[model samples]
Target: MKSVVANYMISRKWLLLALVILLILLPFVLSDFRVNLLGRYLAFAILVIGLDLLWGYMGVLSLGHGIFFGLGAYIMGIHLKMEASSGGLPDFMMWSGMTELPWFWTVLQHPVIAILAGIIVPMIIAVILGFFTFRNRIQDVYFTILTQALVMVTVTLLISRQDVTGGTNGLTGFSTIFGFSLSDPATQRVIYYVTLGCLVIILLICSRLINSLFGKALIAIRDGENRLRFSGYDTSMFKVLVFTISAGIAGLAGMLFVMQVGIISPTQIGIIPSIEMILWVAIGGRGTLIGPVIGAILTNSAKTFFSESYPDIWLYFLGAVFVIVVIFLPGGLMSLGKKLKRRNSNEKGQTNSKADYSAS
Candidate 1:
């Protein structure tokens, strides 16, 4: 236990150093477009981490995370539109034949309410869904299918409501965020930094959370719910709590994503996008926290690169990457590190045994 703790401490310090270097150098090395791409990826990294908390560690395969993400994005998008119009209708609103903003749009005028909604809406939904689902002991692929259905239902609702949701076009033409002109390079950089800071903060929070007693309980449930239940732990409540945490984190990521991308649409919350989110965690390695973060960054970065280079073949390229990761790197990139560590440990043991044999 002492050795494990010490190794974790050292690894954390190293990861911290890596984050510092990336934040310092990334903006200068990348062009504005690339920086924006990275910003979006960083936001998704938060989402992946949140997904990892529930699906990766707790054995919950959620295909509905995109819905939570979209909810948060929509909240932030409304606020951006409100700030741009200064309490009037957004540009899309004008194009859609709406002369006046709705009553709900009034709350968006305040950034605080918008931000709170971004976090709270997802949490509320997750809590409600989780309460019934966990209470009924629904899990595994059954839970995943239900989640996918929820996303489909939400997307259908959003698409059907043309006036309020901007219909298929889905909320665009945002002017500012919290008084900062998003179009300005300075503002963009500030947003990027804020995103990086958020990624770091979420990483730390998750690390601590996973190491706590609550985290241990979730792992217990993940490994063997029957045993945990027998041991007097309320497995269902633990699952609900973890699920809610995952949803909140996804919401946070969604808010950051809308700020950078300047739009939120039904397409983002649809079934395909939700599956892609799972791919992000799967390709990165589900059980390891760091794996999801690395996976999101690499996969999204690759997507940007591929789309820019060969727009026609980017989807195929992404598909191939997913196939390759699933086949060869079942543990994700983080597993490679673990494999190397074990190999090194074995070599050291052999060397120590040989030295002792010689002394004897």
Candidate 2:
């Protein structure tokens, strides 16, 4: 038994190592377009892992992550827009007959400040939302509903406030970033690697977080919040912290995504995107950190492929795939390995028992 367990662990290590190597070599092996697509998916992976931490471990499902993601993307997009404007108002603003930048937009004029706000703004929003909701002990379905509602409200506001937010079009027309032309293929490849590096960093942080006592508390709250509270732990605080951290991570993903995608629109942050984010976590096997990453990549890749090949039916195809995964594999894709291992172990045990019976 010990030998078998040891071998399994070793195999897992080798598998992980191979995956890392594959990711590192992908840019070299694939076309620039494919590499960019994978890079965008990597950004989604970051978002889903954070969602897993919140919904999978902490037992809080938030459909409003799209808002935090949009906040970060918009913040970064605003910076790029400002730079593109070059000491003048953005094209959208000028077209709308605005003579000056909004005060909020002005705050993100500096690249460094924009980056900071890209991350920090989502966290601040999370803290405010988490504090109020968790403090009131409003969780589970109510929390989920509120998050979904927030997405609606946020998208509506952004669309309605066209002069400030670029309306339904969101923010685009980014020419350069940090003096590097975005249209340059070399610059794009560099961005792709940077995104991959960020994904690694976020994974490490989440892995460390889950292995710590805080992670245990999160699982505990997920399993039995009232019992944890009865034991004198501040469950609300734990919930709030996890939610805030996850929001910040989502924000970081947004910034990376905007760097590659070149657009941040209200349509992207609307209800459909929020639901898709949740599906990534669910289909990936939420509690397992790596599962969500895999889920995000696979699902988004499928979306890209289908949208390219079968644009008219891609949405239906994606929906059908998720439905199948949920109905048949509720434990998710990660659980398949465990199931197979368990079946093998059971077969071995039965064979041993039959041999003993014959000997008797």
Candidate 3:
């Protein structure tokens, strides 16, 4: 049974099931601090899985995913700010001496609108970015550069628009979410469960997508976009669709993240964060759905552990991890088991051949 599971065979579905069960039970066993941290990591896992669909299956890398994530977070954060302020302008705005609420904030005052907009606004922006880039036949590293540029623009806007966005300080001081006190442990647990549900549902849908024809087209695009285009499929449209979807998924992850972290700042939405997100998918094994999820969680866990002790050099530690993974585990951590199993199988085959010759 051990070897069977170790072989990465079909029977390992039960192992996945067991892992999910463990995740579901975690909140009950762990303290609120640890559970909240897990919730944040799971939110990141959702974002990376979406990224895997793009970079892993569709053959395009985006470094501006933080923009979409930030949009969702800021939308949610703005709404919470309004709620905390009880229909008046947020404290930051008062500090900036603004007389009234901004036009955008006024519209998102309703909870339903805020939630829907949090998810949809990111998709809309993604659609625009996707259409402009993919339709123009801009490919590869150029597309990546555009995304990073988008990050720069976004971070700059958030910082410069101090009154509206809270500038470098970002948005915080949330008393309630939909009239429920955020300070309540029970409410926090509910948020955790909601985050977990989103992660699971997103993964399941992505898994289904990978098994569908659309997914096949994505893989084909990744392998050879021109060859697939020659086969009469609209390669650019497929890229746009996948990129848009990935952005929307990242936006959703950001929404969940803001709820747990209770702050959304320019720092979180900058170029560095987006690059770290890509590293999660790369280090996790991009081609597979499960790999990026594992990579995001593990990498974030390591970051938390290391950053607490050595805040200044933690980034260097992250760079070292990427280097090690690239050199020794090109397929990311997930492939390590498969590599070992294959080596052992080859050795066993050699032993069997020698025994057959001896018997002869």
Candidate 4:
């Protein structure tokens, strides 16, 4: 029976069913506020899973995922604003002294366009960035720094364009998504479920991608770039493709976040948040697909709990957790759990050995 359960977990369909069941039942068990917060975390998990594919599997450290996420949120925000205004100007535009919606905002009248842009804009940006970076054979610490630079550039641009991009304030007051009134509890729950559904879909796609030939190639590239290149792989193209896919996933996460939170801002896409994102991937265990999801959920849950209980020392707690994870369990929380179980097994083995010796 135990083996059967284990085998079921190893199957994607069963794993997905289990995840869906947990998510579906969560709202029943959790308070509205907590359920909503989990919705936000689910969005973050999507981004983390994508990052794990690139950084964990492909060894491509990206610090600009926040930019992609922010882009998607902003795109969705435009559509939400349009939905609220009914072909009029977003309130922020009026407040900023604009007589009419900007020309770029025109396309936002169509939800389909906004959704497509959310996916495409980030992908295009990533492809452009990857083209230059990968072509130059950038990797490791240098690539990380480049990604950080990308985040800084994006944050700076958004902050500088107050009238256009809402500057540091960014886009907000998104009162609706589609035809649904976001203020309604039913609509909010529906959005939450939609986010949960997206999470499950992304997880399955990621699992499949990681287990397929393409996934093997990515792992190979991570393990030995030179060998992969020698073996006739167009490594740069692979990097570009994977990077774009990662950015697009981040965009999807951003859209889900904006739907739940009703806001998008430069602060949310800044360097600090980018660093925190990498931490999610790290503390989750980079190479393992499930590690990032675990890390995001656990870290976010800890942050929520600690901030409410001891807001003054929450940063210290986060720091302490990072330090402990780094020092004792370099592979991450997942590895830490495995280590404890292994130690218990070793101790039990020793006890059994001693018992047998005594009997002899």
Distance from true location, Cα of 271 in model 3, Å: 0.8
Higher lDDT: candidate 3 or 4? 3
- Model 3: ten consecutive residues of lowest lDDT: 351-360
Q: What is the lDDT of candidate 3?
A: 0.86
Q: Give candidate 4's total backbone clashes.
A: 0
What C-alpha lDDT does candidate 2 achieve relative to the native structure?
A: 0.86
lDDT of 1 by residue, 141-189 (tens): 7878889999989999999888888788888888888888899988888
Q: Which 10-residue window of candidate 4 scores lowest in summed lDDT?
A: 351-360
lDDT of 1 at 127: 94
- Model 2 vs. true fold: TM: 0.93
TM-score, model 3 to reference: 0.93
lDDT of 4 at 304: 89
Model 4, C-alpha of 193: deviation from truth (Å): 1.1
Report the C-alpha displacement of residue 125, candidate 4, in angstroms. 0.4
Worst 10 residues of 2 by lDDT: 351-360
TM-score of each: 0.91, 0.93, 0.93, 0.90
